[model samples]
Target: MKSAKSETLKGWALALPLLVVLLGFLLLPIVMITIVSFWQATEFSIIPAFSLENYEFLFGSSVTYKVFWATFRYALITWALTLLIGFTVAYYLAFHIRSSNVQTILFLVCTIPFLTSNIIRMISWIPFLGRNGIANQTLIGMGVINEPLEWLLYSDFSVILAFVHLYTLFMIVPIFNTMMRIDRSLIEAARDNGASGRQILTNVILPLSKPGIMIGTIFVLTLVMGDFITVRVMSGSQAANVGRLISNDISLLQYPSASATSVVLLVTVLLIIGTLMRFVNIRKEL
Candidate 1:
């Protein structure tokens, strides 16, 4: 009984720092934002008046609806592309790369982009896609096109490509970790039992790796949904996303409306992640 009590105390002591941080940063900010969302802008200061007008405006506006749908559509596409590309890379690394040292080097290379500022990385694309860029010069030199393609620099395609480039590694890491845990003997046994590589992968490997795939998908979806920088930098004026819309509201000093929009976005993302978490052991991956 004494030992149990001591262990419980130790656990609580260890958790106290995390608990304090959560309350200070996340919980307090959320509480404040919730309160602020109810405030109304009077002649001078925002008055504390509880109303659903902000949300009503957000939902009622056709512009917000379009932006929300755009955000959702981008997230869906990003998640799909991340899964496909990440799975191939992770599968090859886990199964084909026999040398652990080489695998480690490859993984480090994959993470090098993350070491740099994300904004810098996004900006780098402009040089490659600009009017006097390599893409244009090469195209014109090779006679593929007589002129530079303006569409390449600022379009939905560029935005999606940037998203896939940035977040694919997030998906890859989780999938790779899961793939590495798969037993080598399982594959050998399947092979010895007259199963081909494709059959073994389809029947055995895929089912076992569902947790990783699910986790990667969720991560990509949530991150893409929340991302503003890539959309703004890559899409230019051709596209509008929810993050951009929220930024516009904040810039215009529509604090209550922005808060309401943020609250809705946070709730929607949480609900989606929560639903996915029910079917996955996300804790194990972490």
Candidate 2:
């Protein structure tokens, strides 16, 4: 009984710092945002009074609906691309690479680009994708096109491409971790049983990789949903997203409206994550 009590105390002591940080940084900010979301916004200042006007305005505005649709579209595109590429890369690294030294070297090479500033990395693509840039020039030189590709820059395609470039690493890391943990014997056994590569991957690898995929999905979705800078910079201010909308509101000093929008976004992301969790109990798999 005494030892159990001591263990409980030790656990609580270890958790106390994390609990405090979460309460102060996460829960507190959420509560404050929720409270602010109920307040009234005016031309000059936000009034500290309970009102549904913010939500009402948000829902009644067609622009809000369009922005949300665009945001979801971007999120979906980024998620799909990242998952596909990440899974392929991770699979090759985990299963195909025979030498651990070579695998480590390749993995490090993948992470080298991330060592630089993300903003710089994002901006670097502009010159490559811009009109008269490397891509357009190359295509033009090859007589592949008469003119530079306008859709290559400052468009949905560019935005999604940038998102995939930036966030694919998130997917790869988690999935690689999961894949590395998989039993090699199971794969060998499947092969011995005359199971093809496709069959082993479908029936064995994918099932075991669910936890990592869930984690990667959560990361990519949340980051894409909350991102304003990437949308602003990559889309050249032509496209609107939930984050960009919230940013505009904040810039205009419409704190209440921004808070309301943030609340809505938070709820939407939570719903997505909750739905994903229903399909895969990540805790059990982990």
lDDT of 1 by residue, 123-191 (tens): 898889888999999999999999789878888888988899889998999899888888889989999
List the global CA lDDT of all models: 0.87, 0.95
List clashing residue pairs in candidate 1.
Answer: none
Model 1, residue 231: what's the lDDT?
A: 96
lDDT of 1 at 233: 88
The residue pairs in collision within model 2 are none
Model 2 worst lDDT window (10 residues) = 40-49
What digit string (tens of lDDT, one per residue) describes model 2 on residues 1-286?
Answer: 9999999999999999999999999999999999999998778887899999999999999999999999999999999999999999999999999999999999998899899999999999999999979999999999999989999999988898899999999999999999999999999999999999899999999999999999999999999999999999898989999999999999999999999999999999999999999999999888
Name the regions of candidate 1 deviating beyond 4 angstroms.
42-44, 284-286
- Candidate number of the best TM-score: 2
